[model samples]
Target: MTEILLLNGEPLHTVTPQLLRATSYAHFSSLQVRDGKVDGLDLHFERLDRSTRELFGRSLEAAQIRAVLQAGLAHTDGNASFRLTVLDTDLLLRIEPPIAPSTTPVRLQPIQHQRALPHLKHTGTFDLIYFGRRAQEAGYDDAVFHTAAGEISEASIWNICFARGPEIVFPAAPILNGIRQQVLQRGLAAYETSPVLVSELASFDAAYLTNSIDPALPVAAIGEVTYAPHPESVRTIAAAYASQAAQPI
Candidate 1:
């Protein structure tokens, strides 16, 4: 499980202070590359393109991104966790060991916070990391962010969803539209996008978080409310995600 770093299409050997500072103004998307293919590959490209346009006043071509991803995969076994970051117009590809979906349910501590640019997956993650560490220090798995008015937005680095019977509810807040969430919503039979209040969490049958790495991770508890295990729901969600066709890079 060797890690490979590439800037543009060339190898990145060292990280100077200037390079580190330049990368702070970047936005990135991560995906698990299995067998040199990626599920929701188009969505990842769209995310990077949209973020680049909005953040840098320029568009990044999907073909260019695909080329960099392919270059990075060529150095690996074609199975790894890959991240494509846009530092202005430059592309930074990081390939690392693949991550499997979590089997254990996560416990989240609700925190009052919001990301600077909620729509884009930008590099300003100081609050996210800080709150996550505080939650871990307090014996929780991670932190779930909520607006000052108590509207649940998202978790530290994942999108949050709640289940009520056969319906999947996504909180209608200013948060990043995660690629996995978009794919799951498309495959789901019944789903809703609405404002979810933290106080109303107890009414839900189950809770879970989704990201590029973990598609459907059950939430055992959030704040003081606890949810019973819902393995069937998780299986259904995973099936929907797995049913998607993986496109070659």
Candidate 2:
């Protein structure tokens, strides 16, 4: 489906080259809205605010951002995905059909690269799409990115988490702290944060991917290392994430 773009919550069909180029300097948050409610809505706004301050040296009010998102949500129906971008004083919203969360497992190809300013959700479409395409061409569903130092960071579009018996371990490397990942971390009991290394994939019993649209997607393999997709630990983490309450936009 084609996306609907809105500037300051108003319908926008034509974009100037200047504004298009502005996307490179923008900070964005990808989120899912269901029936006008979004899980981790506050966290999403907080992320935008933090990124905006760090990247553009500007402060963003959560209430104002919520108003803008609410207006954009009015143009869509049911479950929809929104990419809210802040370019200086302007707010751009891209509304599109929601991605169906997969119950099926997926394989990941490791890529030796790290994101600049790993904490902010800045535009890295080129790197993500390019590396992701390379992975898909290699017969993998997605790509997992790591530092040249051999630290496993995150996936192209999701945060990677590992299941180790009774606990869940998140990669402590610098990466985009996804809203869904935050929700799971806060909701789950047996969760720990640690640096994950490429050589350590075999040490974990299971693995999964988490993001705004997907609550939890099991990982079948990472290169040659295989994992049990639907482990009990993964199920527990997924259930914990699912139990989070949705906040109004």
Candidate 3:
């Protein structure tokens, strides 16, 4: 799949050195666009606007954002992984090949670290990248982050959730409230948010991770506590997410 980059609705043929030297102080949101529609489209927009306001002290124009996205999609087959990034006041859209949801379970290494501003999906990802690479080096799929107090916050680029029988529990910690997580919470009837500690992992029956790319992928293990692969729970969560109505771009 070809990757395309657009800045403020204009296609870029080349990247100048100045563009590469820009500060990494930006916030962004990513979503999978299938058939020219997105499940949590409004949520993505809201996240981008809110983060821009918080980071730059101003709000992004929704109409302008929509126009830019529309412009970018025009160059694709309407199926792609789209990312809208706000650097200061400039809007940048990156279009890449769409990713299919993963069914393979993942093993995570618990790392005691928290992001600086956990709420916004900002561009400062050095910590997550470093820890995730360390986890992979340690024979783990990815890194699951916990606070200094040992409360499970989130994983690298994803939010972690636990399954207790028929109920789904999201960690009530300072982390990015992911768009896919929010959509699942609203779609599911039995769910709650609470502080999840690493000590409590043994009590949960199953676990999964959520992000824009995949709605639910079974977590095989976290540290030493291993979870039996629960395909039913994964299907339930995926069904709930699939039930949501997609909005056209």
- lDDT score of residue 195 within candidate 1: 90
Model 1: per-residue lDDT, tens digit, 48-150? 8888889889989999999999899888888999988898867888989999988799999999999998998988889899999999999999999999889
RMSD of each: 1.2, 1.5, 1.3
lDDT of each residue in 127-201, candidate 2, tens digit only: 889999999999999999988888899999899999888688999888988999999988997678988999989
Give Cα distance to truth, residue 146, candidate 3, Å: 0.6
Estimate TM-scores for all models: 0.96, 0.95, 0.96
Model 3 gets an lDDT of 0.88
Candidate 3 residue lDDT tens string, 1-249: 699999889998887776655537788889899999987888888888888788889988778789988998898898999988887867888999999988789999999999998998988999999999999999999999998888999999999899987789999889999999989987897788999999989999899899988788789999999999776677779778777888899
Q: Which stretches of candidate 1 lie over 4 Å from their true place?
A: none
- Using lDDT as the measure, name the better of candidate 1 and candidate 3: 1
Off by over 4 Å in 3: none
Ten-residue stretch with the least lDDT total in model 2: 229-238
